[model samples]
Target chain A: MAGERVQPATLSRSEAALVASEGKAPRTERGRKTLRAILDAAAIEFGEKGFHEGSISGITRRAGVALGSFYTYFDSKDAVFRALVRDMSDQVRDHVAPAIRAAPDQIAAERAGLSEFIAFVRGHKEIYRIIDEAEFVDPESFRLHYATTADRIAARLKAGAARGEIRADISDVHAWAIMGMNVFLGLRYGVWQDDVSPEAVADSIAEMLARGIGTK
Target chain B: MAGERVQPATLSRSEAALVASEGKAPRTERGRKTLRAILDAAAIEFGEKGFHEGSISGITRRAGVALGSFYTYFDSKDAVFRALVRDMSDQVRDHVAPAIRAAPDQIAAERAGLSEFIAFVRGHKEIYRIIDEAEFVDPESFRLHYATTADRIAARLKAGAARGEIRADISDVHAWAIMGMNVFLGLRYGVWQDDVSPEAVADSIAEMLARGIGTK
Candidate 1:
């Protein structure tokens, strides 16, 4: 299976096996579209019922695809779940990229990215269930998700430092701190309830980041 | 079962039914000690084998008590697991409270709390697995664990603002953000690896909190 794998765009090496392909781009646009539908359905099935209760037939049912079509893209339920974890990670990155890129400074970029993330989570409430479940179903994928996310944040902070918009001593610790803050805030303000404004939450965080909480 | 329940010292109303016993505290000191042993052992058992594979027998064996004794405190495996989640939450709060109290200011208090949390996690590595697994095993317990933890953090932040040690605008958003930061930092530095100094990690976060990450 590993030998026959062809990496999809944005598919990390660790995620390659879960998204099984025959080492070539033989999948037509329709086939790719079908695979996308299957994943989307799996997210709902797993999200609502959880892994133990969720089934492959249910995924296909939700996708409006035949049972055989699931096997075309995934070897089993586990494979699809693994694939979904990576896809969600990529989806989050892709969804928030434009906002982060458009912001004028590092702090603004983080603020926009967080606002966009909360907005995304509100629409895709299943995201927390799916990603949190990865901890038990696939530990490596769970670790990589946060590791990659913190790395991305760290890289951005480094760039911000180079531009002199942030302190010179930024480290991986700061990256993890910011990432953790964003994640829990999203859970509390986005998925759990919707009354708090995302912009307001992000604005508060942005202010905190711009100036320490210590009284002047 | 609900009618006969008695709440433990720190058991939230949501977690009251899990640590089952008669509506009275009739057990002797030794019995109470035995119950404590069972919970600590259950932590190891569930932490290692997880909920499905972890057994009541394994918990008894680790606790060095007989199987019949297990039933004296808990109604069943599910009961013990739920009880353990609350215990862990209480344990974290108790462990960090002294450090937080001794700090000279809010920023130092936060740094101390994060450092203490990372240290606690290093020794009780199973904490992450248990609290996280509660999301699947017992959703309410999982929710209350985080909800209560965040509530405590928010209360502290609010108190800090009153003391003029922190900004007047601190809110639940900042509390969740800080809680999330400490949790992830504990996972990364405490459980995942031991090379990074917990004090150093907490120090950087303290610096960031004391004076926003923005350049002067």
Candidate 2:
């Protein structure tokens, strides 16, 4: 999946800083790879043990990097956890963006986005734990995660409206309604159980979005 | 709200047992009142300090009840926390039941439920904290809270479908999707900020439910 996407030719100065701790970005490709590895490991560690119980050493060990190498990218356990939240958020966005963009219409785009989201959640079940845990461990990131995602949804919705693909009265409320539906559906069908396929879930929601539950 | 609703003629044996710790249920009206006070205090204490930092003494002091009174209702901090989760779950149901029952149709009932829910959240802002903390402090209660709530929603949606008030295809997915929408809407519009009124939020959703965002 990662291979299918376009890779950056070179990291911008800020992008490099983002890969490192305390505003230090990786200067080389190898450095970026190490940063990515540490984050993946942190996801597993934090997702399993939670924030207080998860440690820098555990992440480094899982990443197969030395303790010194861990600090080279992150200042502390908190920094790494913060970075991981953002990384996961970006991962979801990147993973779902293409499917959404490729959809013929807004409703199809939403259906595609939800299908991809559930698929992502099934593969990375820990994403729910880590993101949910953020509410207690890091409140700011928790707020940012939802707020940013909701904003993105709202933007897509408005764009859809402008193109006459959907109703013109689209607002933040619709965005939030759609987002909440997706989040809980992901929790129920993705994290909790897998009896239903993602395609079916998305299809049901898309049908509802196209029509509605009203009898009239 | 409680006054407007029908009260139980008298607490049944099992109902009495529910108000007290373990097998103890308050036998007298005074005992029931005391139990209510303790639970209310626990909400405040747990809401402010969270489960770990919250203490029995804090709850007692807030309730203005003796230490023995606290012991009479709950054996430990954990017990009270668990009870509080159930209590709040019941509280939300009781508070919203009247409005929902009064609505003209299924769609109107949902709108009313969401409106009343946001209003309730605004007044009892601590609800979000307490219930959310239950996710970590007592996983069982946390799951029960959502599961029970979702079940109630599913039942209501099914009832609406039976009455031909909603589409015949109403299923658990629709129920979960509606519940998710209400929850996040409550979190954003209810708890986070009150810039928008609950009525407006409900109005927007009700409109979407009646038609949907599709241009067709």
What DockQ does every candidate get?
0.57, 0.53
lDDT, candidate 2, A101-181, per-residue tens? 999888999999999999888878888878877887788999999999999999998888888777887889989899999
- For A125-151, candidate 1 gives per-residue lDDT tens digits of 788998999999999989999999999
Which regions of candidate 1 are displaced past 4 Å?
Answer: A1-18, A21-26, A212-216, B1-26, B213-216
TM-score of each: 0.90, 0.91
Off by over 4 Å in 2: A1-16, A212-216, B1-16, B212-216
Q: Give the per-residue lDDT of model 2 (tens digit) for B133-192.
A: 887789789888888899999898888878877777767887878888998999999889
For B1-216, candidate 1 gives per-residue lDDT tens digits of: 111213223333333334555452214666666777788888889998899999999999998999988887887899889889988898789889999999988888889999989988887889999999999999999999999999998898888878777777788988999999998999999889988898999998988877752222
Cα distance off (Å), candidate 1, residue B79: 0.8
Q: Chain A TM-score for model 2, please?
A: 0.91
Query: In terms of docking quality, how is candidate 2 classified?
Result: medium
Each model's lDDT comes to: 0.82, 0.82
